[model samples]
Target: MEFVERRSGISLWRQIADQIRIAISNGEFDESGALPGELALARRFEVNRHTVRSAIASLAREGVLRVEQGRGTFIARHTKLQYPIGRRTRFSAGLAGQIKSRGGFLKSHVTEAATGHVSRALELEPGAPVLRLERVSSADGVPVSRGISWFDAERFPDFANRYESRKSITAVLNSYDIEDYVRISTRISAHHADPATLDDLKLSPGAITLRTEAVNAEVAGRRLEYSHTFFAADRIELDIDHQAGTALP
Candidate 1:
């Protein structure tokens, strides 16, 4: 029996939706690529048909399912893209072979004083100037991640304009005479999507997100950028390479 706690305060439908998502990840629906009818789901979960319907509705809103009126509910054809995290991680390069189109564009940019978190990440004083960029990355035109990055404004006064003219961060850095940068560290976690990230990634309220806080520095060890990126949980899988310079397939 699927354990959905009756009096546990969590809504029944939400619990069921999570159960269905787990089952999907486990390939339970591979045979048909569609969910069983609501009646069947209700019986399997020991819930009323209405409760099952609500679960399916919620999953549909999260892009996990496609509810076809006359035919049947089907899983969305979203195979998770594998993203490699290594010393030389580049967003476009990581997903290049797996996707037909990949791009990241600036949604907004600002020059502001460093907050405590940003200051520490960029190795700057509390009130030091920084340039921040808000960006969205897409795979095959479907937005999959949102990122915020900070750079030392004094060092790269023209960073935003250079990045805007050239969509590639690597390219912009190259123009700044930075021949190479390496990922110093990357920290990853999963959480319920915050309101801003949810909107940026076009995800529903309860959707989960995989977040990474990464720092990059030049070969000689001068910090170049500190960034936080949120990837829609359903659409991407973060692959950590034990080998520093390993390439993804």
Candidate 2:
């Protein structure tokens, strides 16, 4: 049993809930398919029954746990969409067949000066001009992810307008004679949703988000796009696919 961290600045119930979620993900309770009783959890975490119950209630609200009148709390059976990340990753194509529909329009775009990691990822000099795009993606009519991408403004002067017209990033790039590109690198992590993301994802305060920082470039190895994305953790799962034809032709 992992003792709940004391004076960790986080609420006792929230810490307990996070631990429980991790335990469920690890299949620690799969044999029983239900969590230990409130009393047992209370003792294990050195907290009161009320604290343990609060944790359970939060998980239940998140649809991670199901509670019955007499039966114990059990893990909810959820079918999260599997999103593939590989050398070539695309939104709609990655979720094909798994979803009845997949598409989202650009929310906004602007030309801004590149700074910090954005400059490094795209191999642009610091303070160079870049076209930034803010977009959201959906699966089966439900919001799944939000993304922000940056491209060299000088190189793609009309990216925003072209994307708006084509409604496809690939098409917009293709018009520039960029026939093929591949993902150069990607970094993944998890964090709690920020206020804006919570509103966009329609999730409560404690909802989790899966974050990815990725860069894509042409076959000639010229970096073209640098992006930051966040997926609703409970609704989508990311998988690494190294096979050929990872992206639609």
Candidate 3:
């Protein structure tokens, strides 16, 4: 309330916007919850309707709010569910543990010799056999992520075929005697989606996404799998936990 700054160097609209952002970050507005009405905010800030509108527009463009016609402006609330970066977990398994509601569909499977990135990740020759599985996961029917996973074909010749009907990649790995594997390293970054990614994830062209790249190895530290997953920033939040003594070996 009373967000306007008459003598500050910052513009009135910008000051209003900054305060609203601070409120959102501080949990003033619940995650994924509705925001105050424009007239209500205008009254509280002692500003004209146009001033409040401008502040809302700035926040919307910055991915802080989503304006739904007829419904109202809502806080872009997303909870970043952390997937353990130090332990090997299947996509469904990890997500199930983090998010109470989850769903997914396997998209495709490709079997070929590992090349370039895959080979380098697995520490094998460029032509080493590998199986790739593509999947799209969702929460409450909203697309959350697109994933591609690669496994050593020599170690799991049936990986591609068996995984087609399986929901848990860890189960498939277990069938191949890879009873346990741990995450070696996880890299995270933010980027906009390409045309293909946009189509697969059903995201707007300008939407932001979080990319996670992870490598997994047996207990002995022999790398066996690598995966890349892209998450829709608007729909889902990612959480990461790094407890002491659980770090990658």
Candidate number of the best TM-score: 1
Give the per-residue Cα lDDT of candidate 3 at 115.
81
lDDT of 2 by residue, 1-249 (tens): 478888888888888988887887787885658888899899999999999998889778767889987998989878999999988788878888898987787888999999988999999999999999988888877889988999999999999999989988889999999999998788888998888787676665667899999989998989999998999988899997867433322
Residue pair clashes in candidate 1: none
Q: What is the Cα root-mean-square deviation between model 2 and the actual structure?
A: 3.5
- CA shift at 237, candidate 2, in angstroms? 2.3
TM per prediction? 0.87, 0.85, 0.68
Q: Which wins on lDDT, candidate 1 or candidate 3?
A: 1
| lDDT, candidates in the order shown | 0.88, 0.87, 0.75
Clashing residue pairs in candidate 3 (N, C-alpha, C atoms within 3 angstroms): 32-77, 80-237, 80-238, 80-239, 81-237, 81-239, 82-239
Ranking by lDDT: 1, 2, 3
Question: Clash number for every model?
Answer: 0, 0, 7
Please report the candidate that would top lDDT against the real structure. 1
**Candidate 3: which stretches are off by over 4 Å?**
1-72, 76-82, 97-101, 244-249
Point out the higher-scoring one by TM-score: 2 or 3: 2
lDDT of 3 at 177: 82
